[model samples]
Target: MTAHTATTLRSAGSTGISLPEAIRRADLGDAVALLASAKKYTVARLSGGRLSVPGKGSFADGAGVAGTSTERALPLSTSGPDAVFEARIFNKDAELRWLHEGDGLGTAVVLSESPDICRPLGEFLDPLYAVEQIDNRYLLWGRPLRSHDSGASTGPLSTGPLSTGPLWVRLAEARIGLLDVPVSRAPRENECVFLRTVEYVTTEPEHGNAYVAEERLVELFLAPPEQSKAAGSPQPDRLPEATR
Candidate 1:
């Protein structure tokens, strides 16, 4: 299939659009559709070759599965800073599981992976105020609340209290590299594997009644546990100004 670039809508006004709706209108479909189409290196298929485009029938596998009642344990490495941390993106709860198992640190870090799953997770979370839904399975990472009296400027607009929110391009440019790793064919229950080089876009809701915003070309990177920290740190706030 030919690749298509999705358009973003900023609000719920006449021409404004919600992030989810914009994604559908952009013809990119859901998270799976966006990921499958954006990354040429990843292989995706449908049961009958119907072409799983978003908003057209049931496209992605396990599209509406409920969240898993039980949390799965992730494998960690014991090799200190130099180890491999593997994660599975598919879960009934739509969560991304990060299992770090190598040397001495063997722990499972499970947050709302869906925040990281969508195209503009960073943009959404940088704000100071926004509403989120837990039943949606996908994590809605929103920014903190902003006061109308506090004059903070962002992006192209400058207002005393009404900021323009975060910049989408900066979020998209964050240098998260992608890797394709070999996944296990047959694994036990709650066990999943995957090849790397995964990519997807994110749509974050704006504060108040403004349009839902989105970020494109969000890349996923896999690095050594130590390298991942160094790369992800530095900014250590919301989304970095720029990713390598």
Candidate 2:
């Protein structure tokens, strides 16, 4: 995954139309085309209950009951009802469930940030997209490498470095010292640290909102490596420009 290689893959068979741009113009054909051009991610074509992977075996759906149907989604995994894909995001692992409809046209992309839900039993999708049988949609799934640790709670319950305000080497969509607390991590030129929020505020304050002092440090998500490289190091005052 060198810089040159990544650039070459992105330029390969490119139509000069990005996914967001195609969606903005309401161009389904261009969007599908752009998605198909992506070389790094898995892209499959579905037709007549058969899924055709470019360099893999074609899978046929199994027997089904009345309302629910089983899909033989071997591209993600084999001999299981679950389909998971793992991708590196923000230098850490982010997992999402790859669920498909009876026809395998519609997919439910669920983020795996919770542990209570079994990895096999997935949840609903966030920012779901629709694609025809001929179109290709990006899939994401699987539990994080540290699945033994629970990701469901946002509170800093563990008395490890997490509660002691670990130093942050990077950040995204946030600024240093935004929280009303003492900043002890003496961030470098572009680095920051986690801070525990002493109070919490809720929206709809005009109506009725709870005011409590919740001792917890909100989650911090880092930017993707590609985006970080593109934007360069972030300044203390501003975050890096978002990439499409």
Candidate 3:
């Protein structure tokens, strides 16, 4: 029912809970499930450079991230199709600011405070957005970076690609960073949560998994089409581009 559900394997209280305790209990599976299922969450789009955790006063970028597990936390994530939703959650990254009881680190942002996305956004994204629910990963159809007119995106996120193709995110990675900002349903995309970055991320159509956009990341429409039948539904493994 809540984002914390991913952080903790056990069901989180529908209302009022301790952020640290929830995170402490959350495992990778719980986090992935939360990201795949939560209606919204705040996801951090890597500003630039490789993903790294910042200490209270400085940024740390070492390959071995295991040491920061107990103290690392990032305070941002973009949600909603096309990444229109953004929210601030407890500052659990690097600073461990949440450890301070009265700092208001884990305080949840009010849904009303989020911006409104035009119905067109939902309509535009609905055909391409969806949640995998079980795979613990976000998938999207891929388009080249040049396909768009704007070339200002110089960040590493312009398009999602591995050594050969587009990029993919672990469900837990996306969910933990995202805070679903609220918007009333206009187009169906408004009804779901997505993984986004600061810049656009690209994935190939045949890739099955979707890409994450930067500024407003895209959650690939992996779910079955609202208009389609489920009898022969395409699973992620057989992704015929999951949704329309």
Candidate 4:
């Protein structure tokens, strides 16, 4: 009875030899499904259909291919959560190493032609330091030059006043011309603002293994406390300050 059953099974297997080819041929007709997985897998067009499977799944088993995909071609997702997490840990470790073993901060001398440009710097180091000029540069003194019920810091930057705040002052001194607005919320006129920002840009998954790197540029803007302002109430004769 066992021999008879084995013979029957062998016959069935022999007749089903064309089954794998038939399945592969049918799969090739649906090109969309194959292209959909292209981001996560190394998809290549075969003679009849496309090959779409996981890194571990064998093309030979599914598409009746001869060998597995190459190592460089298989891992399409090189920068996943795991890679990013590892990169963060690596950056932290590097910072800690620098803090422990790197040379500490050192003082440097920056000679300026005029003291007007460098005067507000003292206020950053010591908020109590008094600033003398406050006409257009009220924001540099860390006080609102003008305000409204809306509570917006400054009017729309384009039409807002030009105070020649710290950045503009420095840029003017250095003769640097910026044709475009550098900051997203660039301070208008007299505001002295400090901002720290990070931006990450990634390519589409169809591009295959992602390329990533951390690049940073630190630019600091410092200002002062209220300068040339005195405590006083407006008399009936005097007009109130303009709040645009």
Q: State the lDDT at 173 in candidate 3.
A: 24
Q: Against the unseen true structure, what C-alpha lDDT does each candidate score?
A: 0.23, 0.21, 0.22, 0.21
Query: lDDT tens digits, residues 89-163, model 4?
Result: 001001000011112111211112223322322221211111111112111112222222223423322334333
Q: Could you tell me how far off, in angstroms, the CA of residue 116 lies in candidate 4 after the best superposition? A: 32
| Model 2 misplaced stretches (Cα beyond 4 Å) | 1-91, 95-118, 123-186, 190-244
Q: Which ten residues in a row have the lowest lDDT in candidate 1?
A: 165-174
Which ten contiguous residues of candidate 3 have the minimum total lDDT?
A: 1-10
lDDT of 3: 0.22
Q: Write the per-residue lDDT of candidate 2 for residues 1-244, one digit (tens) a residue.
A: 1111100000001123222221222211110010111132332222232332322111112100011022233243321333322211110112222222232222322122233321232333332121111111111111111111324222221222221222112122222211211112322222223211112222344865433311111223222234333444333334211111
Best by TM-score: 3
> Per-residue lDDT for 73-172 in model 3, tens only?
4442333342212122211111101111222233211111012311211111112122211222222222112111123321112322222111222121
Q: What's model 2's lDDT at 73?
A: 33
| lDDT (tens digit, per residue) of candidate 1 on 34-62 | 12111132211111211221232221232
* Predicted structure with the largest lDDT when compared to the true one: 1
Model 3 residue 232 lDDT?
30
TM, every model:
0.19, 0.17, 0.22, 0.16
Show model 1 residue runs off by greater than 4 Å: 1-14, 18-20, 29-217, 229-244
Between the candidate structures 1 and 2, which one is better when assessed by lDDT? 1
